[model samples]
Target: MFPIRDHNPSGRTPFVTYALIAINMLVFLGYWGQFSAPGLDQFFYTWGLVPEQILSGRGGLTLITHMFLHGGWMHLLGNMLFLWIFGDNMEDAFGHLRYLGFYILCGLAAAALQIAGDPTSNGPMVGASGAIAGVLGGYLLLFPRAKVDVLLIFIVFFRIFAIQAWIVLGIWFGLQLMNGLGATQDGVAYLAHVGGFVAGAVLTFPALMRRGGVQFWRQTHGQPPHPQAKYRLAPSHIPRVPRK
Candidate 1:
């Protein structure tokens, strides 16, 4: 299942979130399909976070640069979609600058954990999944009861369900931990995701306390502090067909 949107819209325009999406898109386009397989691997080695390179006291910049790189189209799209769905409310709560800082910090924490988990591995890690996992972490802490519409695909069947934020995020966090434990050269940085998520929640705790902690949840009923958005599906105009 994937979250498509949230009921709680930001009170103001989320400039930082929009800028992040645009930047990721533009950066992907800069290198998309422009290199051969060998060249692409070389590029990732240079820009992506490699545990060995980092431990060797080199390629320091990859920690930050890797967050902007993606392995493929699906990788980029999935991360961007999560960011778009959950990022606005975070930006609204933390404001632009703090939110950006939180994002980067989460990414750093993710990289650190991944490196610590397998320092000997030479594989390059790419994509914003780790950082986006941080956003999910913060979102869960602040708005556990907020309604999120998730799209569930079951083979040929598909459906949308409006689930509470806590349930969705809780399950996601659990999956990361479960997968991280059994992980063996799977090429997915489940540990990084776990680290990013925990860091996001921890960093967001201060803001939560300032808002009155449990009292804050009481005040807003564990939802966005501002008014929640209501949506209605438009009726389709396609003519119905009758079968004999």
Candidate 2:
């Protein structure tokens, strides 16, 4: 199950989040026609993170640039969705410019870890998953108890239930760390997730401490400054047998 929405809405417009989403979409579309395996490989090799290129003191900016690139439509969509969902509040907390810096730096840290994890591998790493993972990290630290709307689908068996952000993101992070350990060379770079997450948490310290340290959670009590969303179920056509 994954989250479809959230209860906490941002007090101000998430301009950076929207812009990032649009930019990612446009970039992905710009290269959609070049999705052939060979072309895609070349594209990533040129723009994606190359430990050799980085270690050689060249193409260092790719760690940040690659955050804007994506592997496919689904990859772009998934990253943008998560960024949109949690970015606003964090951006609000850190302000637009600072939030942007945090995001990029976390992505940079993510690439660094991946490179250190496998410096010789020629695989080209792309996508904002690592950076968005950073956002998840910030959200977890800032709003551990906040309510997040998660859709629990059970293949036409179970129902959907809105759970807390802690649960949703926490489970995701746990999986990332676990998978990072269990499968490092599987090409997913779960280590990036772990790295980005740690970076978000560490970097967000100033803001969190400024807001009265641990008391910030006590003050906000793990809720966004918006009204909670109500969930509605789809209409079913099952017939009732008069309680038989």
On TM-score, the candidate that comes out on top is 1
Q: What would the per-residue lDDT of candidate 2 be over residues 25-88, giving only the tens digit for each residue?
A: 8888888998875777878888898888888788777877788998778778788889988999
Candidate 2 has what TM-score? Answer: 0.89
Which lDDT value does model 2 have at 226? Answer: 52
Clashing pairs for predicted structure model 2, backbone only? none
Give model 1's TM-score versus the native structure.
0.92
Computed on alpha carbons, the lDDT of every model, listed in order, comes to 0.90, 0.82
**Residue 126 displacement (Å), model 1:** 0.6
RMSD after CA superposition, every candidate: 4.5, 3.7
Candidate 1 segments whose C-alpha is farther than 4 A from its true place: 35-37, 234-244
Candidate 1 all-Cα RMSD: 4.5
TM-score of each: 0.92, 0.89
Cα lDDT of candidate 1 equals 0.90
